[model samples]
Target: MAEPTQNDAHLLIVDDDERIRTLLQQFLTRNGFWTTAARDAAHARKLLAGLDFDLIVLDVMMPGDDGITFTKELRTHLQTPILLLTAKGESSDRISGLEAGADDYLPKPFEPKELLLRINAILRRVPQNDEIIEKPKVLHLGDIHYDIDRGEMWEGDNLIRLTATEVALMRIFSASPGEPVSRSKLVEDLGRDRGQAQERAIDVQITRLRRKIEADPKQPRYLQTVRGSGYMLAPD
Candidate 1:
């Protein structure tokens, strides 16, 4: 919007089609984003190892390793935001993409404008690290302390590792501590389009988060569900 700034956030574009890759590179460059093109997952992986990317635009229908499978594998270590491109528009396909840990998904044959909007939306949603803050914001839940500004969780002196989705959810909960955040709100906060499947997916992430923060996830104390309302994060 604001000329996208010369900050020139690095972007990785992974697709099998040569024409599409070239077109996307041109379009993104014109909008002030630095982009690299990869023909497939292997090429993308190689480039990923060499360069750091602010975001990744991946095609889900690659010949060898499909984007969904690759996304699941990437979730093991990388917390980089991924926007998936796919031709399939079925609900099941969309759910699969989200379940695989994609930050967002855009169906193929999409307008360049839409792609631009989605990219900006995701960039805006990235968590802010508190390393530079003079006074960091921390939420205390029992023995676990959540560093809001850094998107991190700690147990006394020890730090915990969280998946990308978990970090996103924590960011949302931290933003409005002690308030009830609806399932739909969590879906939107996680960069997911609203729907039953996305809501269900949020439930799964919440369960995982509870396991990390609660002494007994089945009987969550800090993360409690408000019947018919949604989930609330109660900190001490």
Candidate 2:
């Protein structure tokens, strides 16, 4: 499979503020990404049902089903990368958004160039098809199988969906299957700023990922905690 070029990447921008949404759409389109705008969560959902996007730009505050809630819902199936926009700049607020499964968060009043950089950074973290030069390796976890080269998880013939962050985590774990990856290291490798909040967010993402990989997430067998070391992927 060939990787999509920057010009071929599609982005969805969801904001209640029409002016802001329009401006962002125009700005991103001008910068080479295919941009689509939604007035709110409902509209965004409708668009999502019909169109596939490489990334989503979602605003935190909205009339109904706020960004955090919507992000959680989206993670149930969609793996598209999400970059949240929020008026609140507090670390707690940012952590909450991440806990809800957002790929990244950008505080409001941010420069357009900064947003572009953040978007690019997040997209770059995603595994590209061309990056797979080695022979494909499949990790067995009970009935589940993870393809390292394709960055896909499968339970028999049914493919399980993984969020962009989950895909990134899988690549890191598969690189060193038996070794522990420190939470701090996971945060840094994910291209996030180093902080306790980001580490906690990584923990949340790990938990979410376990739900997909483990038959019983409460007692994870493959993706295991390594006491003070961090987490390890013990494939069968």
Model 2 C-alpha lDDT per residue in residues 1-236, reported as the tens digit of each score: 22234546899999999899989988887788898999999999999999999999999989999998999899878889999998855766677787788988898999888788788878988878678536879999999999887888999999998878888999999999999999999988887778886788788889888988998989999999999999999999
Candidate 2: how large is its RMSD? 3.5
Model 1 worst lDDT window (10 residues): 126-135
Query: Which digits, one per residue and each the tens of the lDDT, describe model 1 over residues 2-97?
Result: 345225789999999999999999999999999999999999989989899988999998999999999888877787888889785665655677
Residue-pair clash count for candidate 2 = 0
Best by TM-score: 2
lDDT of 2: 0.88
Q: Model 2: how far is 85 from its true place, Å?
A: 1.6
Residues forming the 10-long window of minimal summed lDDT in candidate 2: 1-10
